[model samples]
Target chain A: MSDLSRLSLNQATIKYAGMEQAVSACLRAEIPGIGLWREPVAEYGLRKTGALLRQAGLTPTSMCRGGFFTSPDSDQRIKDLADNRAAVDECAELGVPELVLVSGGLPDGSRDVDGARSMVLDSLAELAPYAGERGVRLAIEPLHPMFCSDRCVVATLGQALDLASRFPAEQVGVVVDTYHIWWDPTVYQAIERAEGRISAFQVCDWITPLPAGVLLGRGMMGDGCIELRRMREAVDKAGYTGPIEVEIFNQEIWDADAMEIAELTAARYVEHVL
Target chain B: MSDLSRLSLNQATIKYAGMEQAVSACLRAEIPGIGLWREPVAEYGLRKTGALLRQAGLTPTSMCRGGFFTSPDSDQRIKDLADNRAAVDECAELGVPELVLVSGGLPDGSRDVDGARSMVLDSLAELAPYAGERGVRLAIEPLHPMFCSDRCVVATLGQALDLASRFPAEQVGVVVDTYHIWWDPTVYQAIERAEGRISAFQVCDWITPLPAGVLLGRGMMGDGCIELRRMREAVDKAGYTGPIEVEIFNQEIWDADAMEIAELTAARYVEHVL
Candidate 1:
């Protein structure tokens, strides 16, 4: 049986919940770890939030998002780098070892995805060392291909690993989210290949007839067609003993009470994933 | 300049038009060919439709679609095969050499994509010889990965090519549709690898803020962000000299007058695709 002790809640799942409430909910529900978003950390004051989680005996599993180096404008690129550097500092301040990076999409009026990808690699070359110095690994999260043109150029776990492979496994890794990589034919092989560099394993079921904007369609566990158990098994077999973060983005779920949602997520994780 | 002589109007782009009107409109516009859908041809009397198009000197580029064998139920699978066989017969009667196949999604209550994919291959094995004997090639059109669960298990051009490679190039081939494949990072390499096996080249741009159903979100050419010209150039370089069929599925376009839509599609084809 898969381990339930490592279950983590990404703050986005309960979109309306503040960091204090989310961390408290996780602690109350015995969800050992929680993934932090930069906005929430900023809102709560990073140092205070870190102390709150630590005081409550909660682990900060991973940090959400620090990568948007695809801008064609040099000034924008410089600003993005500064923001990313600040994100790295935030990771260190929060005592989280992994910083999740969602590489930005293509530049304005540019259809050059290759150029965007090259910028990601180039930025990583500059930032990985900085992150490594601060003892925080950067985890590249590959968003689904549906978001390729606007949200993320890295649309597959294999592509994430390809980029991550350029840096040391200690400094860079990949995030395997079932919602994003479930449709990939070679995902199992990619998971096996990801072995050591699998920094975070995120779970979110995929339901179709996607709503407008496509961002809020991530269904809760056991709610969609994704093989949650199968994906969990693959990640487990890949030798990843890290926390499995539940990171859903559905609107209706977010409208519910935070504690109720946390309990439901835990039950679903046990039944459908663990 | 790209050859407009090879341009074909996929009937879906002008969904409001009857087969007779579509054929007449193509002829009026000096368009060389048309890709047809089964429902209209069946409604118009297949043989009569074929005769009408032939008399109008319009080539029958391809027939739209015949593959939905992902049902877990044996009876449904049998029915799907029967329907596909009937579609192949219709292809012969319509004088269309290519029959597009959108392999259906996961079976009910099942999340096994691998199992669904195997069913596709098995169904293809049964249908390929039947199609080949009828002088038709089954063109596996991989829908975007977003549709993998509910529409098609064949979700990548590479996966389509892999399946097609198992059969003779004359009997089985791949359809390269820009709307479905524009997000694929390895698409250009897949196009290069699809040399001599590309049965059809379909064009449609992809616009963001996908609609509620995400089905009718295909943009008119040049309105969205796809590198349509690059994809056209890739297909041409890959030795696919077949008709370039415009196949958009936007509801707004469908509500417009058929002749106006056809003219706009042709103009867009010349400006954005060719």
Candidate 2:
């Protein structure tokens, strides 16, 4: 069997599950790691959630997010920075070393993508030091280009690596989520270039006929045409010995039982992504 | 008034119009050129369509497409090649110098994108010589990465240029469509590198919350956030003094009056893309 110890169930994959339930599901499936999200940790109370994971012997793989620093509103921008710092503090409390950063999209009524990108970099310069001081690495996640307008402007692995390379590798890293970067022709080369900067290696499949909002269309492992095992192997070759988190966001997957989803995900990971 | 002499109205912008009607509409709107599609040319009878275009003093800017060589079935591959050759023949008959090529997506149940990409190259090697002999330049159009799986595997201008460089620039070139490539970080640089091999320059806008199938979601020139003028300037700076074809694919656009649509497109081309 593939190493179950290295498998992580990102809470988003089982969207309906509470933080407590997600930890229990991971425990029941013998999944040694659980990737936490900021909202759920806050909902369950950070200390209680951290204690729950500790009690279950489950490692907190990484925190879900902490970026969105491209708001056009000055007040919102300040709020976003403050929120990100809080995320870093949460990571410290949860003992999670990595915090995924989703750089926000272009500002409302604005076509200046370069400006938005610069804002992300500027925010990172401020936050990276804070995150590093708390032993939390900021993992810049290059979301799919389709999400460039409203979700995240960092659209390619190369761009993410270029930004991450600007900071110390430990302070600023990248999340290689296959759903977003699999379409990139230079992805393998980018992976090779991202040696020590790879903070989290997330896997999900890419099935098309993308649904309306295009947000909840990710396929389950082996349910789509992504060469999952190949991507995992590339990250491994890049010297990343980190947890491989399954992070699907489909509505159908969310409606299912959390433990069943976790068990099936583990099985699929072994079958198709080992 | 911005230059109208170099404008071409691709029939897709007025999707409901028949070939003859599209030609007449372009002529009425004083649109000097048009980009033809194979199906409509075949429907109107290729020779008749060619005669009609010549009679109306309308130039055939480029042929719509001729690729899709990534099918897994051997018979389908043979058929695709044969169809592409016929498209080349049609281009020759119509006196169109360029044929836009959209390389097919992955074969069903296949996860090897590299293998699929190689198939496109091999097919190009075979077809390039045939197209060259007929004086028809094969313009490889790298679609948006969202279409990388189901529609076309060539998903970036750089990748298209890489493939185009392998063949004689006269025989193989690349299409710079703003809607498909605007998200790319290196698009302007790629356009400059395209220099002598830019066969066609197409424009459309990029609006979000893409409709089902995402095929007909392309916005009319000024309806979305793309820096249309900037992209056009980049193409011009790259030394391409050719027809600027407006190729939008949207349901509402298709349902509008073709002549009105053509007139508005011309106006928008001047206001936004010129």
Candidate 3:
């Protein structure tokens, strides 16, 4: 059996709940790790949120996101870089292991995805050293292809590993989220390539006959069709002995009681995924 | 400028309209080509639909779909192969140049995408002779990765082309559709690789920040943010001189009058895409 204590709850799983409540619920459930987003951190004020997490004796696995590198203008790209630098600073303050980077989509009024990816690489290279100096690791999260146009340009595990390979291992890496990469044929091989550089391992399930819009149907663990045990085996083979973070973005789960959701997520991890 | 007479109206654009009405509207609009779906053809009676298209002087560009080879049982796989053979016969009877094939997603209760893909390739190899004998070319259409779990397993243009390269060009080829593949960084290179083997070329825009619960939000030529001109340039440079078929699956267009939608689609193709 896997270690249930390594389970981390991403706050977006219960985004309908306030940040303090989510932190408190994680403590109540004895979930050792938590992943946070900028909005909630800002809403609660970082210092207070950090103190509360410290009080709850929870370690932050990662800071939710940073990096929308593709933009129509150099000025916008520079602005994004500056914003990411600030995100890096925030990660350093939070003492998180990694800052999840979601490479932004096609630039406005631009149709060249290759060009947008080039911009992303250049921005990552520029941001890496600053982040490295601050002891903050950058974790590129390859979102599912559904978000290719508007959310993130990096859309597969192989693609993320390819990008990460371009930079030093300590400067850049990848987050293997089952929600985003469970469908990739090259996922296992990509995981093997990311062995030592595997920054985060996120878990979620994919539901069938996805409703008209593909974004809102992310299923919670055990609720959908993904074989969590198989994925865990792949991660284990890849030598990634890290926190198995549950980062579900389900509409139904978000509206339920925060504490209840956390406890149920913990129990589900123990019964199904672990 | 693109050849306006080479424009093909995929019937799914105005899905709410009956097959006969869509064909009549396209003929009236002086559109030279039409792509048919099996459901509408079966509903309207294939003979009636075929006779109407002939009577109206509209050329069938290609069949809308034919492959969903992944299944839980050997019986279903065999059945899928037989169904594909039938679809090939339909395409040949309709004088269509190619039958579009969408590799099916993961098998029922299975998450092995590689296994599903291997099943698709094996099914294709089995069906290729039947299709070739009927004078029907199989055009593999790679769907967006979002469909990898439920709809189609072929998720990238390069992946589709790579699969096609495994067989004889006369038996297997690729359908390069902008909406499904525009996000790929290697799309331009893939199109170049597909030079003489591109059986079909499709056009549709990719809209951003799509509404919730909608997976098939295909934008019209100028509606969404895809770089249609650049994509057309790549297709042209790659030595493809085929008709650019407009295949939008937008609810907004489907809800409109068939004739009006046809007219607007033609105008948009000329104004923005051509």
The candidate maximizing lDDT is: 2
Q: Tens digits of per-residue lDDT for model 1 on B1-274?
A: 4457989999988888988889877876668889999999889998899889878899989999899889888888899999999999999987899999999999776788999999999999999999999999999999999999899999999999999999999899999999999888899999999998999999988788788878888999888888889999999999988899989899999999888887787788888887
Q: Model 1: residues >4 Å from true position, as ranges?
A: A1-3
How well does candidate 3 score on lDDT at residue A187? 71
By summed lDDT, which 10 consecutive residues of candidate 2 chain B come out lowest? Answer: B208-217
- How much is the lDDT of residue A21 in candidate 1? 91
Instruction: Flag regions of model 3 displaced more than 4 Å.
Output: A73-78, A208-214, B43-48, B211-215
Which of the predicted structures, 2 or 3, would earn the higher DockQ when compared with the native? Answer: 2
**If both were scored by lDDT, which would come out higher, candidate 1 or candidate 2?**
2
TM-score quality measure for candidate 2: 0.98
* DockQ for every prediction shown: 0.73, 0.71, 0.46
lDDT of 3 at B163: 85
Model 2: colliding residue pairs: none
Per TM-score, what order, best first?
2, 1, 3
Residue A210, candidate 3: how far off, in angstroms? 4.3
lDDT per residue for candidate 2 within A1-274, as digits (tens), equals 5679799999999989998889889988889999988888888899999889888999999998899989878898889999999999999988999999999988877778888889999999999999999999999999988888888989999999999999999899999999999989999999999999999999999997898878998999998989999999999999999999999999999999999999999899999888
- Model 2 has a DockQ score of 0.71
iRMSD, per candidate, in listed order: 1.1, 0.9, 2.9
Docking class of 1: medium
